[model samples]
Every structure is written in structure tokens, then in C-alpha cells.
Target: MAHCQFRLVNGPPQRYIADGVAWVLDPAVGGGGALRNLGIHGVDAALSLATGKLGLKSVSIANRIHPGPVEDHALLVLEDEAGALFIVEAGYTFASMRPGGDFEWRIVSANATLIDHGDHVICATLDDAAIVDLPVELPATRYRLFMRDTLDRLARKAPPPVSIEDYVAAMSLIDAAYQKAGP
Candidate 1:
């Protein structure tokens, strides 16, 4: 069971927990936090990213009001002086730096879909599919460490390193592994 907990330092204090850490979809409560701000625009984009189709009929947070389908969605939140921070409580499988931690593990999924969120951008996709069937026993800490490493690596470069071919290759392996492992 991949376990993950998300906490926003500056924004409203909101937390969410999930399994597997891929597609981080933890329920949200009313607040100004990242999850809450995942308003209609963001939600629509997420749905599109997940299903790979546009024209989302409607979207609601906890079954609220859904006006209509949206054209685009982006789930990123950038602060004035905070640089760039991607609010990814969904569609991810990794943890990040902590107050006290020496060693780290990298377990980030390579798959992702880009979404243009007007001002910023958001990527929504499954974590690397490799761990699909590894086992529920895998520690959540592993995912946290993976996320930490991914973000740290991102911070070190002017333009992050990404290869669609590599991502596709990794995802294919994950798919094959899952097919063989699943019943």
C-alpha cells in the first residue's frame, strides 16, 4: 500500500492521504489550500489528463455544483516570491524532503501529461507504472523519498531533464510487469 501525506507550508494547512502514491487523489475540505483551489478549471484539466479526452461534461468536488464541461485545466500554484510550486495532491507517486532525514530513495513514476493552467502549468499522469503490482507492503516512506529526490533534481537545473521515450519505455515495463503479476 503506497502511503502519502501532503502538507502545504504557506497556503492554508491542508493534508491528504492516499495509497500507492500514484495519481494522488485525497479528498478535499473547504479551504484556500491547494486542494480547495483545484476549482473547476483545475479539476477539468485533471479529468482530461486522466482519461485523455476533452469535453468533460461536468465536475464537482464532493458532489457539489458542476456548471459544464471545461476546455482546459492546470493544477499549479505559483507564489509571488516563492518561485514555482506545483500543487500535486493528485496524479503523482513520491514524497519530498523532511525536517530530519539523511538517506533517501527514488521511486518516481515517469509517466505524466501536461496541462496548461493559464498562468502556470500542471502535469497529470500515473507514477511510473513499474510498482503497479510490487505489493501493498511497500513502505510509504519509499514514495516520499522518491518525490524528494525528483523535486531536488528539478531544482538543480535550469531546464528539467525529461525524455518522452524514456518515460514511455519505463511505463511499458510497468505494464508488462503488472500484466504478468495480475490474475
Candidate 2:
């Protein structure tokens, strides 16, 4: 059996993130605070790519930067049924050196290791390596894509890229992780 590892990280406390936190930093209302709000998406994507269908074996979490009502930094460690490891580090507290988003995703497989750094994706193998930039046409505005897909579906059009059921499953994982983290 072969295992693939995926990791995604983006952080360093930018104003846009802080501004957006105003709308989503509630622990009472949501299942989690910073980890759930900022980290769930990356977890979802990494899990999906790591396992076609998640056979989640176990989950654990470590929380940091808990200033007030909610945490500002969290580390999530998960195991798939196949025993592949998945770790997601999410935070809103940091001093950034770069001006742009600090986003990065890496996929490590037996044959190759691929990395996505917003503008480009790089693939490296024992034999060769290459980097291909993402087309400007395809931006990372997931909200807009979701809205458009929902509208299209409602209009009796194509099926949505992801269904609500998928979201529920992802949230379940986040919920389980938080549960294990405890109060």
C-alpha cells in the first residue's frame, strides 16, 4: 500500500484575516473558534486528497494563543484508516515577512512531491522537477464559486462540485478533534 501526505498552511496575522475574524470568531455559536474557522478548509482539502474517502482512525489537537474567548493558534493531528498522517497548523498570531498570503500546500507521494504556493505548483521527483503557475482565470475565491454553483444548481443546471453532505462530514471531523482537545 502507498501513502500520500498533504499539508496546507497560511498565516501571519494580516488585517484581512483580522477583519474577517469579526464575522467568525464565536465559540458559543460555532463548534470551534480559530481552528474551526480558519483551519477547517485546509483540513478538508488535505483529507480529501490524502484519502479518497476518509476512514478516519483517530484525531488529536493542541491549542495555543488563546488570548480571550477563542484560540488564535491550533495544531491538529489526524490519522486515516490507512495510517497516513495529516497535520494542520492554523493561527492568527504571527509576524509575517512576506507581503502576500503565506499559503502553501504540499503533496508527498512515493513517486513525487508536489507543492502549491498560490501562484504556482511545483512537482519534484528523483528524475525531474517542474513548476507550473496557476492561470489568473482560476482564482481561490471559494465563496464565489460556491454561490455560483448553488445558483446554477437551483436553476436546474449542473450538479454542485460538493454537496452539503460532504461539508457535514468535514465538520464532523473538526467537531471530533475539538472534542478530543477538551475544555
Candidate 3:
């Protein structure tokens, strides 16, 4: 198996990586828990969502990204499955944010490039093309109950070949539903 490379970008305080595991940063929620690094395996398939919870609200595919960053990065709308929804930009030029999100980002993949921005994430590059932004939103904790619900829906209706075309189409459906729920 090929492992992805990762490099820490920037933050207020200096960050630390635990050799073969995750990135640990001081958390602000309570007793300063460390925000562990979740690598490629954590995002390989939808199942990774369960192990590495990157404060994801929901997952969706986008058809077009107009007047946004990156010619074609992931266009994700941040919505806490419980309620709160915000616009999130991923796979863009450099920055990505939910505007008012709480989760802190730490690149874990060996080759995952942390572009100097808040709303974007770029994985290993292929020749001159890179797998840019994987736009996703932060769902409320309530999504915990609906994990199987959403995951199953995606799996059952998943296209046969796991290519870009099929993946994007499915993501679009989920994205549409999220939009209907409002931002």
C-alpha cells in the first residue's frame, strides 16, 4: 500500500505530530484535549467518517462551483446535522472555513498538502493535477444517530464503478437535500 505524505501548515501555536499516528493540538472545548490528526485512511471511503470525525455535518457532491475558489474543488455546505448550517469551502486554492466553525484542522496524510488557507485541502498531486478541495460541512452531533441512515442510503444506491463521475453524481443528490434544508 502507498502512504500519503503530510506537512503541517500554520496555526496560532506550534503543532506536534506523533510519529506514526495523528496530530495532537490543544483543544479549546474543555480540558484542552488534543485534536488528533486523521490521515488518508480516514478519508479513503465513507466508512472513514466513523473513525476520524472531522466535525463533518454531512457529505455531498457538487456539479459546478461558480464564482468560488478553485476551478473545481468540492463545494460543501456546512450544517450541523442537528440544525446550524454554514457554507464551507474545501479543495480550493488555500483557505477553507465554515466561517463560524469549531473544529481545528491538522493534516495527517504523508503527501496531503496543507495549502496556506483555512477552507481548502489538497491531497497528493498527480503529475500537474492535484486532488483538490473535498468540500464537506460540519453536522450537529445529532448526525450520530443518522450515520447509518445516510451511509446506508449512499451505499445502497452507490454506482457500480467508484470513479469521479459516479461519485460526483451521488454527492450532488445529497448536496441538493442539504440546500433544501437551508443555510
Candidate 4:
């Protein structure tokens, strides 16, 4: 992909402790907020789609909606070695506690542009204005599918789909963004 944009937003967790601390908002408890919790997936996807290694370009973090020690929203811009750009946005600032909140993944290339708006996908040609709506049949419980795949791989003595190195690399990118947006 020449360019990719990803976003995930949701309202803050409804449940709070007796002390009025939402676990996700507690630094000690959650380790980090939206960026670490939700945005890492975007980072991983961006990295996978990138033509080459990605480097952080810019970062912005905020806790305006739910002021606390942790940020409720984050935006990250990354550039790949091949000059591709990736933008990632994650937040816990949506107004509702809906299950999936709002999610979108848009990718642009020389030939076409693909946009996935959680429920459906749209593809548009770059040369022409031709657009097509793609159906999405996502499982209600994806964890079951994940587990099945993982177990099957283990039975065959194969490595997991997502390796430890991938996790570390993603986390390192997130850490870099946090460091760049230092207190």
C-alpha cells in the first residue's frame, strides 16, 4: 500500500472501582491507555502493509475527555522507507460504550483505494470513479477462530501467526511514540 490510515475509538470503560478509577485509565494498572491498548493493532497492520521499515514521523496524545494520568486518545504518523505514509488514531473518547465503537481502515495505492468501515468495505479505482461495496462476514466471536488457528499450529509444531518479535517491534514503536510525546 502506498498509504494507510487506521482508526479505533470507543468510550471509556463503564465499570469503575470504588475509588473511581477506571482500570484502563490507571497507569499502574493498565500500563498504558488507548495507544498501547487499542492502537498497537493499527501499528502492526501498518507495519505489515508498509513496503519497508516504518519510522515514527509525529505523535499526539491527549486525555481531554477523561483527564487522568493516562491519555484517552492518540494519533501517530509513520513513514516507510519507500516513502509510504501511515496514520493511526486511537481513542477512548467516543460517546457510547458500544461493543466495537468506531473502526476504520483505509488503504490507498496506485491502482485503487480500499476502505474498511468495520461492517463493510468499499473499493474505488484510482483511474476511474468506479466504486464497489464489498461484503464483510466477520465472526461474532473472533477469539474462537484465533484459538482454533493457534491450537492447530501448535499441533503441527508451527510458530504462532504473530511472533514474539512482532509484538516487541510493535510495542517498541508505541514506546517511541510515547517517548516522543513525553511529559
On TM-score, the candidate that comes out on top is: 4
The C-alpha lDDT values of all candidates are 0.28, 0.59, 0.32, 0.85
lDDT per residue, candidate 3, 24-137, as tens digits?
332222211111122111132322222322234553433243222112223333322333333233332223333323333433333444332234444555455576666544
lDDT value for candidate 2?
0.59
True-structure RMSD for candidate 3? 19.4
Candidates sorted by TM-score, best first? 4, 2, 1, 3
lDDT of 4 by residue, 1-183 (tens): 688999988777443443376676677877788998889989999888887789999999998888777888999999999999999999888888765678888999999999987778899996788999997744334557788899999999999988999899899999999999998
Give, for candidate 3, the lowest lDDT window spanning 10 residues: 31-40
Q: Residue 1 error for model 3, in Å? A: 10
Off by over 4 Å in 3: 1-101, 108-110, 114-121, 124-131, 141-183
TM-score, candidate number 1: 0.22
Provide the RMSD of all predictions against the true structure, rounded to 1 decimal: 18.1, 3.9, 19.4, 2.7
Judge candidate 3 at residue 26 and give its lDDT: 25
Span of ten consecutive residues with least summed lDDT in model 4: 13-22
Ranking by lDDT: 4, 2, 3, 1
- Model 2 reaches what TM-score against the true structure? 0.72
Angstrom error of the Cα, residue 169, model 1: value is 25
**Alpha carbon lDDT at 149, candidate 4:** 92
lDDT (tens digit, per residue) of candidate 2 on 143-173: 5777877898889976666667767877877
Report the lDDT of model 2 for residue 106.
Answer: 64
What total of clashing residue pairs does each candidate reach? 11, 0, 30, 0
Off by over 4 Å in 1: 1-53, 62-132, 135-139, 151-183
